[model samples]
Target: MENCSCKECVSACLNDPGRLVPDDILKLSQFLGISIDDLKENYLVRVPVTSNGHTAYALAPAKKKGQRYIANPGTVAPDYYAEEKGRCIFIDDRDMCSVHEAKPFECGAYMGCRNTFLGKPYRAKTVEEYFYKRWKSK
Candidate 1:
């Protein structure tokens, strides 16, 4: 179980899209076989961003066997930025996610390339619903 102070846990949870609840923190601490304090100090890296797109919290997909974790270009038209104001986090010069290490677990589980937010096991309010609406539209 998490034996750390709320301050420590909150510091650790910042910018983490996983949004680990207290129970999850406890489970993770138990799984890591370390004190929650240590986990918070050593492993957690916070990177808070202004919430933007549906895929903001999406996990990076797993690489194919022996391949690297490269992000693919989204199906946006060339005039996407001209038409829309927001920026995409996935569009690196090399087509890789900058925050690949901190990506959510859902991205790691995705198999369908065309699918936006792949949520089947659990229901999240934002990205999950976004995917549902997108899929329904198609």
Candidate 2:
């Protein structure tokens, strides 16, 4: 397969923010110079995993609702970043990720033209366990 530029993958992320594991959250917190708790409280949304009786965290999208997308006002994305609909809060005016270096595991492993790596099962399970532990402790 030819190496595809990140355009497609970046577009997909902009459309739908990916789910984040605990380690990803930690990395984002460190990158944004914020506490993990603050990040969770302000920028993450809890999604119920009913089958497992647990919850997963996904990054929040921009606030404006319309046919066009809106970049989060709180982030570094320029005000003119609005385009398309349902963009992730972290995508900037240039369609670049503001937190590219600390992107979630799924985003990091995604390859639009190749078989994607969904992370090791053992690692996912371990992270899930850790996430729940921390969630409950808080």
Identify the candidate with maximal TM-score: 2
Q: Write the per-residue lDDT of candidate 1 for residues 1-138, one digit (tens) a residue.
A: 112223322222221223222234345556657786665554442211122342322111112112321122222223222222222332245444444443434334332322223434333455444433433322
Instruction: List the pairs of residues colliding in candidate 1.
Output: 59-107
> What is residue 103's positional error in candidate 1, in angstroms?
13
How far is each candidate from the true structure, as Cα RMSD in Å?
A: 15.5, 7.8
Clashes of each: 1, 1
Clashing pairs in 2: 69-84
Best by lDDT: 2
List the global CA lDDT of all models. Answer: 0.33, 0.54
TM-score between model 1 and native: 0.30
Candidate 2, residue 69: the lDDT equals 34
